[model samples]
Target chain A: MRIGELAERAGTTTRALRYYESRGLLPARRAVNGYRTYDEDDLRLLQQIRTLRDFGFELEETRPFVDCLRAGHPAGDSCPASLDVYRRKLAELDALIGQLDAVRTQVGAQLARAELEAGAALPGGPEPRCELTHNGPTD
Target chain B: MRIGELAERAGTTTRALRYYESRGLLPARRAVNGYRTYDEDDLRLLQQIRTLRDFGFELEETRPFVDCLRAGHPAGDSCPASLDVYRRKLAELDALIGQLDAVRTQVGAQLARAELEAGAALPGGPEPRCELTHNGPTD
Candidate 1:
C-alpha cells in the first residue's frame, strides 16, 4: 500500500507516517514505480505505534515497542525492551499525577481563600474576626 | 533596580524576565543609561506570576493575575478578571487530572497484564490449563 492507504488503514495521517519514516521508525520501501510502499507487516507496525501513542506514550518512547514488533515478537510488550519502556512510562505518569495533585490542592486552597475574603468584604457582610486578638485583651 | 536585581529578588533568572518582557507580560522601563529598570511593584508582579506558574499555570494563564497586580489591586486574585482566570484554570486542571488518571489506570493495567503473561511464559512454568477441553470438546 501507499503512504495514504497505510495511513488510512492505520487511522493516522500520511504526514505522520512520513514523520515516523523520517525518525527511522516505520521505514517504507520504494515500489518499482518510485512511490513509497508498505506491506501488511508495516501495517501491523503502524498499529503498534498508534496504540502506544494513544496510550500517551511519547513518539521516542514508542521506539522500543516498534523495534520489538519489527523483531517478530508475539506482541510489543513480549520484549524486555518494550516492558522496560512501559515501566518507565508508568513511573513518569505517577510522578506527573503527584505533581498535578499537589498543584490542584494549592490552587483549590487559593481559590477558596480568595472567595472567602471577597465574600467577607461585601456590603452587610459578617464582621471580620481579628485572629491576632482572638484571645488577647483589646487595648 | 536593574534587570539582574529584579530577577534575583524574584528568585528567577534575567533571561526569564527578558522572555516575559518579550511576551509583553512584564515590560520594563529603560534607565537613562539604556539599562532596564524595575521597582518594588515590579517585584510583586513577578512574584504573583511566579507563584501561579509554580501552581502549574501557563505563562499566558498568569497574565490576568499580573494585570490585576499592575492595576493596583491588593492582590492578583482581587480582580474579577483574575478570578475568572482562576475558575478557568481550575476547570482546565481538573480535566487534565481526569485524563491523566484515566491514562494511569490504562498503563497500570497494561503493565500488570504484560507482567503476568511474562511470568506465565517463564521456563519450567506451571502446566497450561485447558479450559475448552475441560468443558468438553467443541462440536
Candidate 2:
C-alpha cells in the first residue's frame, strides 16, 4: 500500500508515519519511484504504535517493550518486569490525581472566601479575585 | 541583585530568569560589560510568577492576572473571574488524570495477561496476546 493508504488504515497522519519510520518504530520499503510502500503488516504495527503512545509510553519507553516481543515473549521470565512498569505508571497517575485534588480544594476555598468577604460591610472596595477573562494572548 | 541572589529570592534558576526574559516574561537591563540587573520589585514579580506557575497557570496565562494586579489590584473587579480560570485548569487536569488512569488499566491488563500465559509460552514463539503488543514485526 502507499503511504496515504497505510496512514488512513492506521488512522494516523503521513507525517507521523514518517516520524515513526525515522524512530525505528516502523519500517517501509522504498518503491521504484522513491516513494515508501507499506503492507498490511505495517498497518497493524502502526496501529500498535498509536495504541502504545495513547497509553503514554514515550517512544523511548516503547523500545524495550518492542524488544520484549521480539525476543520470543518469555512468559514468566520477563513478566515481572513488565508488571513493575505498569505499577510505576499507575503511581504516576495517582500523583497527578493528587495534584488535581489539591487544585480542586484550592478552588473551593477561593469561592467560599469570595462569598464570605462579599457579604461583609467593612471594606473600602469589594475583595479582589482571579478571573479567567481574555484567556491571555494566543500568539 | 546579582543573578544568583535574584534566583534565590525568586526560587528559580538564573537560567530560568534569562529564559523568562527571552520569552518576554521578564525584563532585564544589562549593566556595563554584561551582568543582568533586577530590583526588589522585579524579584517580587518573579516570585509571583513562580507562585502562579505552581498553581497551574502557564506563563501566557499569567498575563491577564498580572494585568489585573497592575490595574491597582481592582478590589472585586477581576479576581472573581480568576476562580473561573482555576476551575477550567482543574478540568484540564482532571482530563489528563483520566487518561493516565486509562493507561494504567491497559498496561496492567496487558501485563497480567502476559504473566498468566507465560506458563505455556514457547521459547521462540510470539505470545500473540492482545492489540497492544501483537502488531509487531514478528507477526
What fraction of native interface contacts is shared by candidate 1? 0.48
Task: Find the 10 residues in a row with the least total lDDT in model 2 chain A.
Answer: A130-139
- On DockQ, the candidate that comes out on top is 1
lDDT of 2 by residue, B24-98 (tens): 767877889798988876775676567667767787766555544545553321455555665666677667666
lDDT of 2 by residue, A23-95 (tens): 8877689999999998765665566566666677666655555555445553322545555665666677677
Model 1 CAPRI rating: acceptable
lDDT for A78 (candidate 1): 71
State the displacement of the C-alpha of residue A34, model 2, in Å, after optimal TM-score superposition: 3.5
Docking class of 2: incorrect
Task: Name the regions of candidate 1 deviating beyond 4 angstroms.
Answer: A124-139, B123-139
